[model samples]
Target chain A: MSTPLPDPSSEQLPFEPRRPVADADRQRQSWNAIEARLQEAPVKKLPIAGWGRWWWAAAAVLLLLAAGAWWWQGRSGAGSATSYDLAYKTISTRFGEKRRILLPDSSVVILNSNSELKLPADWLLDTLRQVWLRGEAYFEISKSKQPGVDYFLVHTDRLDVKVLGTKFNVNAYTAQTTVALKEGRVELLYSQRPGRSAAGLRVHSMKPGDVVTVDEGPVLTPMLATAPPDVMADWTSNEYHFDYTSLAEIGRMIEQRYGYEMEFETAALADRTMSGHLRADNLDQLLQALQITLNIKIEKKDQLLKVSVP
Target chain B: MTTGAMPSPDLQNAWDRVLAGHADGLRQIHEALYASMIDYACRLLQDEMLAEDAIQDVFVKAWQLRAQIGEVQSVRAYFFIMLRRHVLNVLRSRQSRRRQQQQWQQQVELDPVFSAEDIRVQAEHTRQQQQKIATAVNELPARQREVIWLKYYAGMEYQQIAAVMEINYQSVVNLAFKATQYLRKRLSG
Candidate 1:
């Protein structure tokens, strides 16, 4: 009595119509068990190759800049950092650019976009391994150089993070400074200058996974390390994470990471937030991704960008 | 430029978080899609345990290589593709090992999860037609079964199937069309 099946071109499939309800429960249990095992595994970090040879040149440049700044401060950080800009170098990445430097002591540093690291010329000559950082950088410092146990010190504007040798990330933008220790040990020393005594520089030891933030004020005060280390998030890899973050903040990030000046018509629009993971090869690609996904409009005029809400 | 919006996981927020490599996202994706992937794997491997193993292997590899792989055009399809490769490799290795040991037995039978009985009810005549269509499909070759599942069960477009199968666009359409013609021939015969 049946003539024939409907034409397949219509995209009709007579496959199993009914799905078992009990299978859902079984699936949930299986997945839960797997998730538990995954949770027990150690956190994974990206593998960094050797880039130690070029650090001295970059550190030297940065040290010169730091010395110039220190001298301008009129002997404020006096007797602490002497002439070390000869072999030392300074390395920096402009907006949308990142650089990697290899320290004289063989420590590896990755300077984030719009970040700078300054090293003195006499870096290996002195007892202290010192560097000045602005913006963000991740360091894999070598603790020992065969015979001698080298001391490492990273001075941001507000605080100084010292470690013999360890892996950590430092974020020292204008707003605040944060240090996250991924491995080994680090000591945070707040630098109290101006009218405050040097004793104000309290030393706080940090363990792995420990993160501390130093706020910007007339005095440097350490905030409680409550929140997890979002500062240590890898931006260079594959994905960008934003959690209800404001458009203004996102714009600033894009500006830093892609060298784009993003503008909004209204302050409210600029403050609008979106949460998603964005993947793009470059700044233009990232902007296109955001626009395509968020149902927003973006127009680029020369070097300026105007993002409009739909 | 796979800008064409592909299907996202039901949990969009969780998917985005997974893309970001957050711990929460990892758990969410595992919970949300693991069962589906395992079921899909089971169709190929037949044994529930082996299917589960294959899926776990794929998921672990996916996680480890997530950063390097970058963003996926379609998360579901990507996972499915990974699972397919893993199961096939496992089958191949087992076959070779069995060959070396000379203990080879019968090939594993893929359970016929897709059947005419799954179609929605209609008139008596339509029901018969649906059953005939389902039977024809179940009888298709291994490659045809794959394209059928990807197109119908996974709801992947022709382009997606082509990309996942590593074939050209025309090849994908031709495969599907050929499968359809084969199904018609079987039903009519």
Candidate 2:
């Protein structure tokens, strides 16, 4: 068989016409198709009369006013609103205090110090199976056999975690959201809010042994770490363990944990790694041990703790 | 076609005619705009089924707010905007759902053959030679594509295209010129 040759003048070829689309005929077909599909789609009768119209108008007016206010405030400023429904629950723990929460679904949440989580009471609803958390939390999501219904979602400000009958730990505080999968597979979505529309929302997914962070914007860079089981659970049990945690990150963690301020003196020392386990109550002793082992001096002035090489 | 039946002109004039509290004017607006709105939505979403769904939503929403819709400057633009918003909402929710199940690595690789640049280049050449110029029209740069769609498909003016695309009049002129030039080159070649 002879191969069909490419047309050399294909680029020069004028537009080709097959048949005209009769708008009237196509419209009739489209109307029929729309009717059939509408029958299948869930239709929520939005009553425009009575209180509903007023409510909607009020909402629209409020939104317009808010938009006007936002423009006046500064068009480019970050604006966020937090709304919670009746089916959701929010738990916040102060610094140095750990809290345990049992969700409306069978999932268990162990919120570490200075952490908070908002989760829906029922995961069976098609629209409301998601959860949002800040700081750190260990989740043991209950398993469900319903094919597509079994999903546990955790949303931080920047990261979104999706799990199907798995255990994972998410440490997503102010700047970063990190996920460590201990069992099964967990999907992590790192979203960067693009400054420009062309960039859109940059998203990345992560799997087991993958720790992904969604920082302030839409860049998702992953770091590899051993999938240690129940590392987050230890925090709730008054134990903190770090396997090669960086000095800078450790310093930040210390600040968050104790509600004290800490800073590294030099950039080189910030990269220094530490590995140890210490009771949550013995942070002072742990800091002393770190100073001795790392050959550094720890200075305290009011609320600030400074670490420096002597 | 009965003589006693309400004349099309009378029916058209019966904007205030309320049939069981439903405005006849609104019904006529939906009837006039529904098909075009669906076509526009389908082009934006590139999904026939989704476009149909969005049109249904638009009709429901229009019916519910029939009173307020009278204030709309252009019913066509209003309906198209509604459909556009609905399609974007659907796309965003779908993206969120897809992000949950799919691996990040698998999803990041841009489709080699169907990249935006390739489509734009191919469209530029093919659009010039076509009799039915609309299909090739969608291949232009987003601004030009939108301008042509509004100008030819919707029978809108340059000023209207400027308003719809949220661009200045000069920019619209430049885009249309550039688009026409590409078409001319392809046709003359």
Candidate 3:
């Protein structure tokens, strides 16, 4: 850190990046933009591009943005695939944030907070729809009876949920993969890809209301048959339903949804269990509800939210 | 190879006028430094529009704090410092945008830092020797790229570069030394 730059800099032949001449017209426009900006309130810094052309620029920018988006994907390698030229689309949400996306086939996917769903850039994998998911999501499949349209597949690290005209929930996080079918049928394929697992590893068929959670191995089990709507899929409505769940658990959900760090004033507060549904639209609303329900005082300091008995 | 640090009487008057917040002062200074600043920024950010935007932001910041800014020593280097900060900010925002939209999985080493090879790949200068220099420069890290550009391209002295880069003078010298060693090793060996 203390070394001095040598006299010749690098190699006695210091390199410079290529330089392009600036356009005089753009300089004049930028000057005008700055001058006009000076006349306005001194609070706002002027935009680099002239603000006069913003609205029209917005539409033009959208077209440019699409191309920019493609370049960005390639630059970042988010697609993480060997194939190039496919405009891969990724949808991710923070904790407490849920996003609904309609696929090209009209299938609906509602991603829960702290989750991601990625669709391949093109329909290149034959007629089947394939998606990669991390965290949790609720999917309502649109029955595509058209010939050549295969079933939809949602892939996780350990398992793949294959659906066709089925409504299902997939919770795939580290060390656990849970798939709960609401209606219709689905197939849970474990390490189903060729060369991944033993040849005998079979695809498990799932019936409606069937909940299968697998860890190191595929374990099929049924969740509550009449699991309350909130516990099952209340996230779709932007409401989280917790039944006798600990305050610590609720705090974790809020942290995941809103990216707020939750700190309890007393250890006992974390152990207190409550059951109810809280809105996920805003942090303030959820905090207010918590304050009223738990009889606790909540203090928010930037990214940290503190819970204490009032 | 002039550092643009040798302040002429005209440039001094421009500096005084900018301090006084005169319209002509701002115009004169902008005309004097606009193109060169853009070129310097283009080295940091390959996108021409982004480079332009960084310089425009620099002008805006300059105007915003014009009254408080007193007589300056090297107006060009001072503005160069400001432009470098803004370009870094733009690069950061672009990186975050990429992360948000595409979910950056791998660490992408943008070795060139908008070097000429990245911007003007087809400038009819792809001869063997030029190609070798380009390849060697492109292999350097972004920090080395900036230091190399500030030293040789912008013609900034070590002290001025340290001021512009907000690093200690010795640190700048050491960085330049390391960059030189790397280039020498690569270009010769």
Which candidate achieves the best lDDT against the true structure?
A: 3
Q: For residues A121-193, could you state the per-residue lDDT of candidate 2 as single tens digits? A: 2223223356677678888888753356677677665556778877778887666666777677777655343
Computed on C-alphas against the true complex, the DockQ of each candidate is: 0.06, 0.04, 0.18
lDDT of each: 0.64, 0.56, 0.65
Tell me, by TM-score, which candidate is best: 1
How far in Å is the alpha carbon of B136 misplaced in model 1? Answer: 52
TM-score of 2: 0.41
lDDT, residue B110, candidate 3 = 29
Model 2 spans with C-alpha error above 4 angstroms: A1-88, A121-127, A145-148, A190-207, A215-218, A221-234, A264-272, A277-282, A308-310, B1-189
For the predicted complex of model 3, DockQ is 0.18
Compute the TM-score of each model's chain A versus the native chain A and list the values. Answer: 0.65, 0.60, 0.62
Give interface RMSD (Å), model 2.
11.7
Which regions of candidate 3 fall more than 4 Å away from where they truly are?
A: A1-87, A94-96, A124-126, A191-196, A199-202, A215-231, B1-189
Per-residue lDDT of candidate 2, residues B1-189 (tens digit): 011123344433443442234444545555566554655665566544355556767666655554665544554555656666676676665555445445132222111011222123334545333433443454566667766656655555677566655568899899999988876665454
Once superposed on the true structure, which residue ranges of model 1 sit more than 4 Å away at CA? A1-87, A146-149, A192-197, A225-231, B1-189
Candidate 3 TM-score restricted to chain A: 0.62
lDDT of 3 by residue, A20-122 (tens): 3455655676677566666654566445346733643454444334532332232232221112222445656655455666565667787776777766544
